[model samples]
Target chain A: MTAEKLQVAFTDILKAHQRISPYIHKTPVFKNSKINDLVHRELYFKAENLQKTGSFKARGALNAVLQLKEKQTNLKGVVTHSSGNHGQATAWAARTTGLQCSIVVPSYSPAVKMEAIKEYGAELVECGPLPTDRNAACEKIAAEKKYEMIPPFDHYHVIAGQGTIAVEFLEAVPNLDAILVPISGGGMIAGIAVAAKHIKPNIKVYAVEPEGKILEKSLRAEEMLWPNPPQYLNTIADGIRLQQTGHLTWPFLLQLVEKEVFTVNNEEIIKAMKFVFQRMKLVIEAASGAAVAAAMSDQLQKLDKKIQHIGVILCGGNVDIDKLPWF
Target chain B: MTAEKLQVAFTDILKAHQRISPYIHKTPVFKNSKINDLVHRELYFKAENLQKTGSFKARGALNAVLQLKEKQTNLKGVVTHSSGNHGQATAWAARTTGLQCSIVVPSYSPAVKMEAIKEYGAELVECGPLPTDRNAACEKIAAEKKYEMIPPFDHYHVIAGQGTIAVEFLEAVPNLDAILVPISGGGMIAGIAVAAKHIKPNIKVYAVEPEGKILEKSLRAEEMLWPNPPQYLNTIADGIRLQQTGHLTWPFLLQLVEKEVFTVNNEEIIKAMKFVFQRMKLVIEAASGAAVAAAMSDQLQKLDKKIQHIGVILCGGNVDIDKLPWF
Candidate 1:
């Protein structure tokens, strides 16, 4: 991969799928006619919220660790820093291979997410709520414990791993006109855009962000944006509050994503979450809510033309019910 | 269909499947390793929660209405009384065929449920909390409006409709040792038992109820028991809190179900709901929780020789998130 390009091929996603099929679930494509009527589009929801570890992170996390083991013989363990699903997923992936995993979590991360990381038998390290602090903690752990650091979104294998979701999704509903993906550190959408665009050459890949639309700014500037991470934390979509896109992922975003980057606020995301929870009977995290909220937004009709069929990825379902956003 | 017996033939369920395939979803069968480890058996969860109107009732309600249209000349409308999922389902089924539907509900039913009935364009009739009041309201509406009464669980068509779930469940995983069904009006279990027993004759069918163990009591007495419905209202599983099994359903219960009818308290049901909501990432109502609770119970391990593969029907997912049981 060059500085201005994403070299992660469709074959890599296919390989990732082949390697992780036993470990991950080919989550069902779900639809609610009520939402379809409101949006005036036939929307197919790729339900990765029902995936193992309750997110699509399991595929990427497992693929990265499994591929790492395939390449290196003396890998003692793996270390990574994430606030939510990725931390838990990496821990689960490590446990599967009998490898020790140390997950550094932001102190602001929900207790339910932390508890899951601990339940997977990972060494839980809590740090201050900043991307820099998380990175420092992971670096320190990797240096001292001789553990290979698995950066959440900035790696090739991780992008390829997440790309597998697109393969399964397109195969399920081949006629989808586009796919709406929720963006955090850009890995999930980056991977999705790569595979989805490859499969359906004319398919539009729309990136949805919370109130803080850093990706949009980055795309307009033709460079990755790095805003204050705390500024992005106001939204209830806790999983995708990271400030910057990855070096490797930003290029994919630049090339593959639709020009119009969609944005929804905390209220919109919560509304989408509630709709799915109450009507559709699916528990979706705030990040997934971004995609759902965007799907239901009037902006879809305001597009260059009406999209007849669309696919929305439900990224995760690890929200704290006791502390529901609406309540 | 005699008063003393259930004759919901396997062919009835098969025909029901063919009739309602376009209207209802073939809900996915979900399994979690963590749940499997806790239960010490492989449990396939039939996710009817994701069905239309967010319950398995859609299958039966649709089958009844569709079959009614076929058999009758001019069907004015369909009417039924239900406190929750069934009412919403019947309203949705009627709307599908552009048939006028009047749903009678007890005053205590959640506003979300009542709103759903209205949203589906059904005439919402609110009655007193007594089951008798609900029945009287339905009878009054059915007579005055010339609407055919589609009872929730007692009728042959409804039984056959609910049985379609068993066909889908067994077809997905044919080698199941037994199916754990959450019982309310008993039509669902009766249809399931007939279809499942016909498919796999030795397959055990276990009935799980909330705090009120009326099914166990009725089975012991060799007759359908009639207790006051209000006496059994002190449980979180509102969907299945009805007092007695249907006349037709009771005979199937006596002949097909295992001798032991397992019962769980409200606490067990809530715990199970939380597990599914948090870990499995599915929004399951308390009726589904009864089957889930039974799966995780200690009594499952104590059963005569370990029954390895069990299909647990997740009856519905129409709980009010704002008023979750744990909260």
Candidate 2:
């Protein structure tokens, strides 16, 4: 995707924001005095963790389903693969439209997530560990059943939906110096960067990633960072353990995002989670923790201090209590 | 307190809301479809747990301090007694005014809470567990130091301030059938009952308490029920283990409240916490859990079937993560 194409993506996202205004929550932005004092930056948290399905995934998922209105008459249903928040969002979106949907999940996924997905009346297809295998299984099922494959972060509609966060944030606080987002499949940050850059070209966009998995590296290198298998992959922030970015979202992010900063280990993530709970009194998942961790890091401290206003995307709040890393 | 007096209390609360509008948050209201289905009531949760200082006590404390217009000229400082939310609120209130303040905390108070109180730059005075003793100590210190005592719930200004929740809730969701609130010192519920009843005379006010606590007995017996020694008691809902209701608040509550309900044991509280965590995806402490537990009971479910809009006050969010009794 070219810079011009990314600009067009911002236009699409802004339009989606207007279109989905009725259905979606215009989730609030919260300022933390303690966080600002500690980070030495004026932080405005875009609280998408408080979004309808406990994640910004809802925006993207809803955007995808709504965009299918042109194809709604001939649509059989929706199909996707997700380990967590995306699956729930897809399920919720399907139920909202009264569409039959099937979500393929890895067998090792948390029971609570599976329950949430099933509770939304979406059919669950459990598969083995490999991410590629799960996608392949979802693709096979989609082909057979003629269900629309709503790729979690790759689809243009999904990017457009997630991009609305930037639109809302910019509208709420227009002088943002930078926005930090947790990147997994790249859909969220990709959309956000495009919208933010279009509105304010100087607003630096930073994607936060976990230490081991680096979609940030892949986006910068402009090639797949391959052979980086999930080696002892364990983090409390389960939302962003993706091995690869989506083909559609990757190029878009590469063109727009300024840099990708990886947070410290799981210990830091858990510590950040506890910090959020104690200071802000908000329940955010590990993915949100990763963003906070990045923002508070020494690496970002100087840039954060230089900025007049900074925004951090609190991406989700769907934390499983039983498996809470702190517990 | 007469119905007319309660109406006056609400009028004061409205004024307090105006005074504190820029400082306080009109926290969001959320509904859980699954929990609502289980309880068979359209449960509207006013999320004051997300309020500043993680409790509704902020309202009363701030209001009390703000009402010190005459004393402002001679204001040496403020004094309050609490090992929990009230202490934090007082500390926060004092900080807002950039005034010196002292908090009398029981010896058994959690370090986390004490740390928070200190973080607000309030002077910490640890006293014996008994409220009478603490009050006496606070009085002695106040007399010696010329500091004004800010009684947590007993004061008129505090109750009026706390009553702001009911004022906001009624305005946000008018025609609510009932309000379920967790009772401790009774300031929160007393204020709420007074305001809610004034607005909607038929509005049922239910106060939820820990089973072993005295609020339930006091409300039922139509008299004061004091703890054996009137000392701090051990309970999961540390924030609500008040030995006695405020004399000022009890009369207000006795006149306006419809009923007081009790939730048995820490297990029930934990179960309620789990319900909020999993179904509602909101963080509620044990105090809030008591209200939820009462609202979910079989007895409450048998109430007016037409009672579609029942609002539950999640009054606080401050829970010691270390002592979170998930086990």
Candidate 3:
């Protein structure tokens, strides 16, 4: 897909915001003077970690489900394959909107996450841990039950729904010079970058990833790159461990995101998570820590000194205390 | 002091709110339907854990300091003896208002807390952990340096300051049938009870305390009771291990607070803490968990069925991660 053809407009985000307004929280923006002093730049944290379902995934899920409800008069339900925040979000959105939803999770998925999905009243389908197995299970469920499948990050509606976060952030901090977002399947960054740049053309959007992810290599090559998952996946930031970016999201990234992708290692991510927990009194997951780590890294020191106001998305706070890295 | 003579008026709380408005945050009130279902009551949580200095102590400390600044022209400084939230709040209030402050902490105070006090630019005075030693050190500092002492609780201004929390709570959740507060020196509860009753004369105000504390005994006797701390203090809630309530605060508690004081064991407090951490995604200390435990306990089942909306004060979030009870 061409960049112009695949790009999400600001209008789509506005519509998504309006449609999902009742079901979602306009999450708070927080600032800490101590963090500002440590990073040598003013930081505005868009705290989607405190969002409904404990992540920004709620916005996209709600938007997709609502859109489905509007288009289909005889909608059976929705099916999605995810074992993380997206799964919980889809289940929550479905329950809130009075729809039957099925979540396909790998057999080895964390019991806590599976329990949360069950608590949200979603049917649970178990498959092998491999992505192909999960996808096959989801396809089978959709084919058998005639359930509409909500893609996690690649669909235009999902990207547009996620883009609503940038709309809120920009409204809260109108003069932010840049925004740093952790990239997984590229849905969040793709949406945020397109919306932010549309609103403020000169504002920079930087993608942050775990050190082992292929996003940086893909961004540099201006093409999709999927390294073997076993060889390259060793980071503790489980949320952004996807092997490659989505096709629909890649064009938005190419058109809207900055050229260089910021990367942080597992140790730095853990340190940042601990710092945010202790100093900021927030229980942010490691995936959110990746963006924070990049913001505090020396790599940002080379940016224009005049780029003083930086915004970071605290993506989620759905961590299992027993599995904490520090523990 | 007689109850009438020591009473804190609602006007005093209104004044304190105005005086400290510029300093402290009007902390957010949060509600989770899942938690509400588990507790069998609609719960509205006043998030003082997100307040300045990560506790509602900021309200009392700022109010007391501001009152001093208003009354005294040549205020040399202020002195307080505390090893917990009160000390940090006093330090933060003093630094924010450009006043010299000294905190007399026990030598056994946590290093993380001591470091925070120093970071707030307050003079640190180390003393023995015994109450007598801490009081003596505070008195010496007050006498030699002419520093006016800001008692942690039990002062008229301090109670008035803490009372401001009730005002905000009532404003946010106007028809709350009951409010549960963790009792330490009785300042926070005393203030809240006075303000809540003044605002809605029939609102039930419950005091929560750790098991074995003398608060329940003292409330039942309708007078001050100073049981030996070493004999009765065996709870994990270190923040509320006070031997007795203050002279000024006791009168307010007797006259304004509800008759029965709710007590929770250390085990129950830890369970509540873990539940809040997992469900609410909040990092609350043990003291805050006391109120949550009381709300979730069967004790509240005896309350009038008309009492539907319950408000709980999440008093603080200053737990030492390294020493977490679960960890």
Candidate 4:
């Protein structure tokens, strides 16, 4: 008899949805008349900002940890290196699932995120700001403690976990002509594109990368390539400024996401963030703002497709309120 | 054989709910585990921050406008005196009901509010910064233009409209031991106390007033009295700083709401606002924050009645983002 392997199949997303629903929120979908008017389209915002741990990271993290619980026995707790939403998400998931957690955060990571991870009862470790430093620190902890390493996005189970968002978003607004997604390590958009296209093949997937063309530049190569040294720190959208796409996530992004991924600058991201706060009255992080910046821009209107009803995943809302970028 | 008179009865709220359901959003009820752990009690927040015009004022305003539309024929327009949420709400209500609207805003009103009122296609008239100035200007406009005056609160229909919130809140969380409401002109709490107590006789109604204890002081008098000048501008919670309770709403406050209203200072209000932004990831106005402040305080835990399950009405989220009070 063949065993089910770890993969991001459509059925796996369904299973992930069932497994993670209890642990995370089915966050609300919001619509604003003024925002719709500004964009001249029927924009349905999937408010994952209100998700558990205040981001969609909750979905992937919980899905991964819960599956691990079912497969393994007496596993040394989970370990991950993330300085943002995913860090808190892993901690929350581990704590909820009755397991210990350790998060390796970059030295320059925001204090708020580190505090949140600690509040979830996870051991917090600080490392250098570089990607290699984060991974080395995370791997050392995993090796020394026999803790299972859960990469932020590359793992197939993590991608499957994030695919659940597409299921929920599509369920809420079934006729969404296309979905506008934010691109980080490509976990969310990859899962979203795969799941969304499977459900409705004609539904296009457009993506936005915050202040960097790494995704755009790398995809042009014959084979996928990661950024050198993998230390990206360019934009105000600190959350989505990953230097490269995940190895597993790259295929889905290259094959499914629209060719023209929107690249937005810090100012554009901030403008979109302000629009949501002033108009929709929802607090969204700059990573989500990049997606919104794409949604709010003029290019969507001039697209070739008759994209009337668009879905924008407001991916997170864990912003530092005291240090608003606008000021 | 007689027609239904304009009165804020329990049935009126039921009717208002039915009538206004199409126009307003049935906003979600949100709960944060972190917040619950901090307060040591489960708190259900009715997110009227996501309501139309970004406030629960939508419920009352829409009901009043729709009722007016049904009662009168060929009305010149509807006019109201409000410098904040109520102003934008009235404009949205009027526009939604296909009625001509004129808003008499105080000169000191925020520019964002004035812009919103105008954007809703309401004729904006600015008056001096005083209660008398606003009312006189509204009355003058109504008399000259034959526009019907829709008072911000104090009207029977308006109170009935406000009561609809209680119906929704109770429906969502039926077992709530008590409800925490933000008091402004008493329209909301009056409607809520009547409707909620009628729905569940055992339910307790507690109210919160932002700094400046007019409600507390007035309840001591022989008759329900308006503020000496009826103009109050204290505390950063500008949305709910009404100097006095409404005539119709005051009786409900005295009779149904617990005698001791929680009076949160500006500091407490701002603190609550910051907590919500940091944790729940919602941009709540200071007015809504006042209600949350009361919910977060230790007094609830020390109360005589066991408020294990508390319902808080986040009255609005029409805050000026650029001018956040905490900053």
Residues B234-316, candidate 3: write the lDDT tens digits: 77887887657777788888887887888999888998888777777777888999999998898888888899999999999
Clashes of each: 0, 0, 0, 0
Better of 1 and 2 by DockQ: 1
TM-score of chain B of each: 0.95, 0.93, 0.96, 0.94
Q: Candidates' DockQ values?
A: 0.82, 0.53, 0.62, 0.85
| Residue pairs with backbone overlap in model 2 | none
Scored by lDDT, model 1 comes in at 0.87
Off by over 4 Å in 3: A1-3, A228-232, B1-3, B228-232
lDDT of 4 by residue, B1-327 (tens): 343233567888899989999999998899988888888888999989989988988888889888888888676678998868888889999889888888998777778888988999999898897678888999999899998888878887788888888898888999999999998888888888889999999889988997765566666553566646666756788877767776667667766788767888888888999988888888899988999999888777687657689999999998889999978
Q: lDDT at A325 for candidate 3?
A: 82
i-RMS for every candidate: 1.0, 1.8, 1.1, 0.8
User: Please, what is the TM-score per model?
Assistant: 0.95, 0.94, 0.97, 0.96
Q: Residues A62-155, candidate 1: write the lDDT tens digits.
A: 9999999998878889999985788889999999988999999887777777888998999999899666888899999999999998877888
Task: Tell me the TM-score for chain B of model 1.
Answer: 0.95
lDDT of 2 by residue, A1-327 (tens): 435444336679878897777777888888888888887788898888778888899999988887895666878689999868999999998888778899999998878889989988999998988867887999898899989888888788889999999999999999999998988778998889889998999999988888777565666677777565433245667788775677677677677887456556787788888888776767789999988888788877666446768898999999977767776
Global lDDT scores for all candidate models:
0.87, 0.82, 0.88, 0.85
Q: Which candidate is the best by TM-score?
A: 3
**By lDDT, who's the top model here?**
3
lDDT of 2 at B237: 83
